[model samples]
Target: MGETSDDGRLGLFGAVSISVGGMIGGGVFAVLGVVATIAGAASWAAFTLASLVSLCVAYSYLKLNAMGDNRGGSVSQLEEYLDDASVAGMVGWTLLVGYVGAMAMYAYAFGSFSVALTPPSLVDAVPLGEGLLRPVFSVLAVVLFVVLNVLGARATGLSEEVLVVAKVAVLLAFGGLGLWYGVQQGSMEYGFEQIRSVTPVVMATAVSFVSFQGWQLLMYDQDSIRDVETTLPRAIYASILITILVDGLIAVVVTSLAAPDVIQQHPERALALAVEPVVGGIGFTVVAVAALFSTGSAINGTLFSAANFAKGMVGDGLLPDETGRASADGAPQRTVLLLGVVAAVFTAYGSLDAITSFGSLAFMSVFGAMCALAVSERDHESVHPLPPAVGAVGCAAFAVLLGVHLWNAERGTFWAVLLLAVAVHAVELLYFERESIVDGVEHAEDLLVPGSG
Candidate 1:
């Protein structure tokens, strides 16, 4: 059933939908309020900056993918070029964690928008307060998607195509109508006047980097894509460019529709609230519904990708082989459940900003490493080193800014993220040295048992 001929593979439209769907799925909806709070009227500029860096990284991916037919994403690329299984394993771990964080962000947005849409009386009647309900709903969403993934219900083929079209249409409509309304009311000019300083914009760019990461998912699905050489590049570039415009438009329109303080106060439901001025209660409902759909799709798509990624890692000997066991249909049920549980924990404990920051930082680190690899391997005539060099430097700089922003604004989250990173690396190290570790454990058991050996 997994076998497919070239005629059955995805074309340019499908490939573009995958990339666009990945990027626009939940990022813009979840991070709008955070960006508005940080960059004020300059939020669009921050998105633009982040898109530029994403473009650079996309270039690196394009070049690297051209060099080989293997499709393990960054791990495969690193293993092939650097020839270091350890580094590849470490990056794969980080990328997997980053995907989990992304799913957490999606679940958070889904829960937030869902809760925002409920009637007040209904919400009030619940035993749990609104604060607790959000996470409860978030965890439930994760469970639902995990179940779906295990059942082999994916957001690909025609399903993904429809979702991409509907999502882009809804977002474009909101942005366009909001912008028109703002201009009609002179709010657009006023909003422009309220733009923040450069530092905040830079910080916002770093915070918003995760939104631009969906395109990277395409790298993992290379086999399903037709004409991988030509179509892949076109689809990746087109999707990112489209996402950039969509993101910028939404940021401008949202900031113009509401004040920064107003958005900050309701970061999770910022889009719903921001659009309320343009179309009354209907706008709120529309945005909330859109968010639910977007976030739901994002969760399903990412969960599936992450599960497959875990399975691939196991195949590569990066993860415990037991985790690679799959269902009859070849679904990595164990890893799917594992990723879902971790994502639920993240959603339950982490704030939107914290999750976004961690996810963005994790991806930035991976992208930077990839870009550095591209630069290091520039001896090939087809690879130009300049763009990747810029990408590496840009990602490094933004990662630092993200750290500073988090340390100053959310010190607790900063420490939590740092601890998580350290833990991921430690796990990677131990996994690589598992044989020695096993031997040491056996020796300890022999000593303790006094002749068991």
Candidate 2:
């Protein structure tokens, strides 16, 4: 077993904040409306089901972290256990693309909320080109964060702390007020009545899975945490449990406040409408502003984590070395820039459903891979076969959900995401092979020379 040497940086609270911040980002506010269309008022139930699946996946991650040298998270675990550079590279690549899709989703949410708040006169006042408002602002949000990250790590961390606290506070207040109103109207029964068949709820789980993406962020902090063994599992459980409760309550509150049809039509602005009856226009404004902050914080946190992940891949020699270069501020400038540009392009063009599917599937696949790894290595001393086995089954259940979604929907973008993933692995195998061989030859030479030079 290994121990953690704390540099007095992140305590239990800090760790929780990182995970919560990453998970809560634009997900609830942005995707809730879409989920409403799927799961009806049972959207909260969908959130609960998705949380269960994510919890199962988290079990595999905790086990993997305990057994291995405390270094990287999922990607590291894959590299160690799978022992295949091409496989690890594919996982890493999918993760990179997933983060990009997520950032684009957040950016899209930011633009949608920002545009909703804009005055009609002001929108018309801008005599600029057509279809430029949301896309322009979305790209601008990406650019702003890229610059913020390039400023340095300290600034980024501090911003996340502030944003996390603020957004959570706003959500708590909103949830409390909405809960009070629901009680007054006895809306719980109505919410229950909205529940339909199992298939829509399952599909909703697949889409809403994006909201829980932040739990993996905790894995990235294994090295910095104070107590590696105890603190890691406790922090992850606490954050996820708390998120599930909070998210469930909020989902119930929103559904109680507004009809499913209303939320579906205004998915982007549903939160504002949910609290409008209780708090009036001020409530709408509050929820809207909170969403803006929520989406922005999500973008910021993802950029920070995604850049670090890319840099780690560079360290592992999975990616081209140049993309990992640091700038004056010690940020992975190249990777950050690349991610920003890609997110910008996606934000500018991709629809919300497309972005959500891409991000959700990418993460769902990663969780599935982790579970499979656990099952494969269950014979290890620290590993158990059951939870990983169960987790693998849970992941497969969600994959079925994805498949159903594709079959019912248009299927064009689904095919694209699948093709893109296949292409990434194929290219990684061909292009990355030469570098792996050179690395192997160099290692062998060093072993043979033994400082002879």
Candidate 3:
């Protein structure tokens, strides 16, 4: 964690920016249309519900952070309290995979928006056709960021603050202008009428939960924060509240500006398309550019964090030492490269919906597990069981809802997510119990040597 200030400490505003930046990343740009498609006129409701879940989860995180002196984040907390390295490693792996999913989604959005903004003549001149263009651009974006990270060029402190502020400003401006246009055109009523059925809204909430996972990144940067007990909680809560407002507002404005079918048709570029009618080409350009910047920055930030996390896990003996190897400039080049390659594969092959679903489910699982850990610490004087208990139950219900929704609508994606989860846990188990398994194999081999017996 690079210091954001001369004193190597973060103030309230800086802390809030980190949380806000984390939450506001490419998530809304990538997942907004999916939410609108599922929740329709009730997209705002879905975002609200999702934020409530995030709030509960955030409470558990805050409590857990306060209970510990180590700034090693969730993995450390899990190992410390549960006294089980295996469980911690599994959760840590899931968290890392989730971050990769997020990077893929961001890259996907960046490519989609960039391609959408390209001239039709140029696109038609290309031999690869439209289908391959997005993936090509996505992979290129991933490679670019990976190279940047390897070169130790990153947005930190003031630059990061400026980037986040610009992102929020763009989003708020688009939402506000779109809302006004909808009102002038008498489209607000139609938008209000689209809010039908609670099931789809709840399902949308499940899908949208990934957009809120960024707030948890703050847990890993506790060392850079000043007055962890006072500033951290306030920053976390304020950031979430602000994100909820922004997400809900955008949902309403988008639903108002465009029909569900329209958004579904171009889920990746929904925001730009939604505002094109009222603001014309200029509006589309602005939104598309914003999406590009937002997603690009997201890829950079997430890649950096995930690489450092892998290095940290290596230090803790949870991962192979090779992953922790740093460059002469002190960058985790290998981990960054590894993560970037995997994220590129995901971007090149996975759909926005599937990637979003997988990411949301992964984070929800980890958050639920963390809440369960919090629940187990009920004896702590400062730890209240009710908040974390509710969080655990809510996360469980949302995860089930996500599974049911995916199974019913996209069975292939559902299997992919499940298979990925199973594979991660299996690898964790194999890595942890390798010695015992090796010993068992040797015993069997000895028994087979009848002459020696």
Q: CA lDDT of each candidate?
A: 0.85, 0.78, 0.84
TM-score winner: 3
Better of 1 and 3 by TM-score: 3
Q: Which of the two candidates, 1 or 2, achieves a greater TM-score against the reference?
A: 1
Please report how far candidate 1 places residue 253 from its true position, in Å. 0.9
Candidate 3 weakest ten by summed lDDT: 189-198
Cα lDDT tens digits for candidate 3, 19-122: 88777764468888988888787887888888887898889888887787665578999988888887888889889999999999999999888788889888
Looking at model 2, report the run of 10 residues with the lowest lDDT sum: 1-10
Across 272-293, the per-residue lDDT of candidate 2 in tens digits comes to 8889988998898888888888
Q: After superposition, how far is residue 326 of candidate 1 from its true place, in Å?
A: 6.7
Sliding window of 10 residues with minimal summed lDDT for model 1 = 189-198
Model 2 residue runs over 4 Å out of place are: 1-7, 126-131, 153-159, 189-196, 326-329, 433-453
Ranked by lDDT, top first = 1, 3, 2
Q: What lDDT tens digits, residue by residue, belong to model 1 across residues 1-453?
A: 112346787788888887888888655788878988888888888888999999999999889888865654799999898888888998999999899999999999999888888888888998886887899899999999999987877654666678778989999998888888888888883234434447888898999999888888888888777777898899889998999899888888877778767888778787778889779998899888988888898898888878887787887777777776633245588889999999999999899988999899899999999999989879989999999998999999999999999899889989988888788878888988778889999999999998887
Error of 3 at 175 (Å): 0.9
The TM-score of candidate 1 is 0.93
